[model samples]
Target: MDRAEFLNRLEAQLLDVPQAEREEALQYYEDYLNDAGDAGDFDILQELGTPEEVADSIRNGLRQDSSAAGERSGQADEN
Candidate 1:
């Protein structure tokens, strides 16, 4: 899909997320597209997978990072 359509759908899908988080996530994808465009790698879209899949992966990564950070915080508290 075109950028506008992709973004509209992405925004709709991420409506449940906090506005700041959703904007950050959308910015990341926009930057990804910009980088790929600069590198002449339009095919990156196909390889990077579907938008929903990409969003899911991002959410998983964020969750993992948050979990790790919480663990680290807990460890620090114990020390």
Candidate 2:
């Protein structure tokens, strides 16, 4: 699929993510597509996988980040 279609699909799948995080992810992918288009040698979907896959990856990353932040806060509380 094309860039617009890919982004649309990604946005829909990211509904559970917070607004700021969702928008940031979309903007990052839009810029990535623009950069790749200029290169003329990159297949973004192939590189990044489908929107479902991308959403899952983003969710997993967010979970890891949240977990790390929680750990840090817990450590700070102990100090």
Against the hidden reference, what TM-scores do the models get?
0.76, 0.92
Task: Looking at model 1, report the run of 10 residues with the lowest lDDT sum.
Answer: 37-46
- Put down candidate 2 lDDT per residue, 12-63, tens digits, no spaces: 9999999999999999999988888844424767789899999999999999
Q: List candidate 2 stretches off by more than 4 Å.
A: 38-42
Looking at model 2, residue 47 earns an lDDT score of 84
Q: What lDDT tens digits, residue by residue, belong to model 1 across residues 2-77?
A: 6556667777777776788889989987787777674544476667666777777767777898999999999999
Residue-level lDDT for 2 in candidate 2: 79
Which residue pairs in candidate 2 have backbone atoms (N, alpha carbon, C) closer than 3 angstroms, thus clashing? none
Candidate 1 is scored at a TM of 0.76
